[model samples]
Target: MKIYTRTGDTGETGLFGGPRVRKDVLRVEAYGTADECNSAIGVARAAGPDPMLDAVLAEVQNQLFVVGADLASPNDSPYIPRVSATMTAFLEEQIDAMETELAPLQQFILPGGTTVAAYLHLARTICRRAERVVVSLAAEEAINPELLPYLNRLSDFLFVAARIANARAGVDDVPWRKP
Candidate 1:
């Protein structure tokens, strides 16, 4: 199929199983943000510091696509698969693994590293923004409970992943302290 679905020419796009909504709708915004996060993760994957990190990031990118799909569906639609607790659990597991390898966090850390690690940090920040937007969306409508927890865990995972990538790549994390 052609990339341009001129069907959205009028600033409206189709939901998963319903009539079109304005491209600016909260659902659209939330899913769009998730898509952006996925792309950012791709950047992190390409800058692989190790095989393990690359493998995990590829998985996260896939999960992000599932998240975007969930957000894109209408509330009344029962046909879509929802984000599940298992996914959240997996993120927590990864976070724990990465944290195990990181130095104790006594102070804030500035985001930078080998170019790839810095980019992962940037993706992590965008993930947080995506989480915030979804939370706001939930506040106004019925959203899958899994979404909040998933995003929350995802942000933590991304932070640790960035640190791990930098450390494994032989880059120092710029620590933040009272100057």
Candidate 2:
């Protein structure tokens, strides 16, 4: 397929099941934000955080594609591989693993530090945005019920992963302070 399909030039785009929607539709917004989050993770991955971090991030990137497909494809349209409770559980397991390696949090930290750590923080915010959009979309229409929990866990995973990246880099978490 040619890279320039020009199909979306008119402010509309096609969905997985052969239907078009305006670019600003909730479904479009949800998947678009998911894509944005995935791109940030990709940059973080490219920065070479660590072998273990690299592996988790690469898996997260692949999983986000599944999330995008779930958001883009209509429900009741066929069995497309989707975000599932198992996936969410896996994130929880990873979170537990990372948390054990991190010191207990006493306060909220500002989002920054090493370059890859900053990128992980950036990805976390984008993941949160995607989750919000996905929630909004769920409220308005049918979606995989599993997606919300998956995204919720994903944001937590990103936050934990960012801390791990900073820790491995020998950088402390930048704690927030009152002005």
* Number of the top-ranking candidate, with lDDT as the measure: 2
TM-scores for every candidate against the unseen true structure = 0.94, 0.96
Which parts of model 1 are misplaced by more than 4 Å? 75-79, 177-179
Question: Which numbered prediction scores highest in TM-score against the true structure?
Answer: 2
Residue-level lDDT of model 1, residues 55-99, one tens digit each, is 889889889988998998866566777899999999989988888
Query: How many residue pairs clash in each candidate at the backbone level?
Result: 0, 0
Clash count for candidate 2 is: 0
Q: Which residue pairs overlap in candidate 2's backbone?
A: none
| Model 2 misplacement above 4 A | none
Minimum summed lDDT over a 10-residue window in model 2 is located at: 75-84
lDDT by residue for model 2 over 1-179, one digit each (tens)? Answer: 79999989999999887489899999999999999999999999888889998998888898999999999998556666788899899899999999998999999998888889889899999999999998888889889999999999999999999999999889999999978
